[model samples]
Target: MAASGKKNNILKVLLIIVLIIGLVAAWLGYQAFMSPSIATSEDYFYVHTDEPYESVIKRIEDEGIVKNPTYFKYVAKSMDLQNGIKPGRYKLSKDLSNRRFIGNLRGGYQEAVPFRFQNLRLKENFAGALGKSFEADSTTFLNILNNETIAEKYGFNKDNFFSMFIPNTYEIYWNTKPEEIIDRFASEYKKFWNADRKAKAAALDMTPEQVSVLASIVKGEALHVDEMPEIAGLYINRLKRGMLLQADPTVIFANNDFTIRRVLNRHLTIDNPYNTYRYKGLPPGPIMMPSIASIDAVLNYNHHDYIYMCAKDDFSGYHNFAKTVAEHQINARKFQQALDARNIKK
Candidate 1:
C-alpha cells in the first residue's frame, strides 16, 4: 500500500509539472502572435528629431505608442537598427511591436515640411531660420560654416564662404542637422559651377571669389534681376578705370549699421576698408550672400564703358548708366528729387 501511494504521489507531481509547462508555452505563444504590426493613422504618435534617443523612448512609452521600451531596445539591437533608424519626426504607435516600429522608422514613414528662402540678408539669418525649422541650433550651424578648419578642408576662402549657396525652396526632413544642410548647399553650389562657368570667370581676369564679390554688390544694389548685368558692368568699368566703386551698400556695411536713413557725407569719410569711396578696389570680403542670378549676371556683365549708375526717379526698376561724372550727378539729382517728393530721405 505504501509503494502504490508513493507512485500516485509521483504521478500527481509529474502531471502538475506538465500543466505548468503547457501554460507557460501557451502564454508565450499568445505574446508572440498578439504583438501588433506597424501602426496605421488611427494609432499615430509624433516624435521630434531633436529629442535624445532615451527621451524619445520615454515619450513613446508614455504616449502609449510602445508597450515597453526594454522590448523595443532589445529588438532594435537584435535587428541592427541603431544606425538604420533615421533621425526625423516619426509616426508610431504603442500597438506596434519593436520590429514594426523600427521598420517604420527605417522606411522614412513621416510627414515632410517645406523650407523656403526668399529675401534673406545675411548667411546667419538664413542659417538661423533653417535651424529653427529643423529643430537644430542655428549658432552651431553658423559656426560650422565659419569654421576655419572645415573651410580649409573644403577649399573655401573667407571670401567664398557663402558664395555657393543659392536661396530657393527646399523639401527637407524635419530632423535634418545644420551641418547636413550646409553640406547639401555646398554640394549644390559646386554642381552649379560647371566648366563653362569656370572658364568664363577666368576669361574675365576674375577669380570665383572676385566674381562673387561683384555679385554681392549687384544683389545689394538692384532689386530686379533684369538690371543685374548692367549694374555689374558699371562696377567693372569703375574697377578698370581706377575709380572708386563708391557704392552706398559698401558704406552701409562698413558702418555696421544699416539703419542710417541717409548716406551722410561723414559716412563716406569714415575710414573703413569696406567703404568703397575710401577703398579703391573690392572690399576684403562679400558684404552679403548673393543669389545665383546676381552671380550669373556678374559672370556675363554687359560690355559697356559705364563707370556710374543711379536709380531712376520713377522707380522704374532700372538705373541710368553714365560714363561721365556730370551725367551721374544729373541722374543722382533726379533720384534725390524723387526721394524728396516722397519724403524718403535715404
Candidate 2:
C-alpha cells in the first residue's frame, strides 16, 4: 500500500510537469501568430536594395517597431526568412505577429510609394523633391542627371532633361535609382511623343524637344488655358518668319531671376542662349517644365497671321496678338501703363 501511494504521487508529479510543459508550448505557439510585436505608428517599412535580414532587424528595432530585436531575429531565422528577405517598401501593421512579419519580409510584398512631381524650375529642384521622399540624395541624382555620358545615354542634356519628367503621379518604389527613374521617363516620353505627334511635329518642321521649348514659352506667357493656342500660334508665326521671339519669359530665364515680375530693357541685354530677344531661334532647352496641355497646344497651333503677342492691360490673363510692330507697340504701351499704375517696374 505504501509503495502504491509512492508510485501514485510520482505519477501525479509527472502529470503536473507535463501540464506545465504543454502550457509553455502553447504560449510560445500563440506568440508566433497571436501576440502583438510591431509597435510603430508609421504605415510602412522601407527595405532598401541589397539589404540583409539582419539589417532589417536592426531597422525594426531602430524604428521602434519591435521591442525585442534579438527575439525578432530568432523568429526570423526559425522561419527561414534570413535569406529570403526582399528589397522593397513593406506595409507595417501595429498588431503584426512574428509569423506574419516574417511572411511579409520573405515575400516581396512592397508598398508602392506615391511619387509625384510638377512645376519644377530646375534639375536641382527636381532632385531636391526626390531626395525628400526617396533614398537617392539631391547631389547624387543631380550628378547622374548632369553627367554628359549619362545624359547622352538618354539622349538628353541638363537643359532638356526637365522635359522628360512629365508632371504626374507615378507609383514607384522609394528605393528607385536615378537610372531606373530616367528609363521610366524615357518610356513615358516615347509614349507622349506618339507617331501622330511625330507626324505633326514633322509637318511643323519641329522636333519634340523644339515643341517643348516653345510650349514652355507659351506656358510662361499665358495664365489662361484658352490663350495657350493663341500664344502658340504667334510664336509659330514668328519662328516661320525668322523674326526674333523677344519673349519676356526668355529674358527672365536669362536673368535667372524668377522673382522679376517685369522684364526691363536691362533684362533683355543679358546675352545668353535662352535670350530670345537676341537669339533668332528656339533656346537650347525648355525654360520651364511645360504641361501636356501646353505641349499639345503647340502641336496643334492655330493658323494665324500674328507675329507678336503682348499681355492685355486689363490683367485678364489674356494676350493681344498682332501682325505688325505698331499694333504690338500699342498693346505694350497699354500694359506698361498698367504696370506703372501698379508700381511694377523691373
Instruction: Assess each prediction's global lDDT (C-alpha) against the native.
Output: 0.76, 0.84
Model 1 residue-pair collision total: 3
lDDT of 2 by residue, 224-319 (tens): 877798889988988888899888898898898999998888888988999999999999888888888889899988898998788889998888
RMSD list, candidates in order:
6.8, 2.5
Please, what is the TM-score per model?
0.73, 0.89
Evaluated with TM-score, which candidate comes out highest?
A: 2
Backbone clash total for model 2 is: 0
- Candidate 1 deviant stretches above 4 angstroms: 1-54, 57-86, 91-102, 106-115, 169-177
Model 2 residue 301 CA deviation in Å: 1.6
lDDT value, residue 96 of candidate 1: 59
Score candidate 2 by TM-score against the native. 0.89
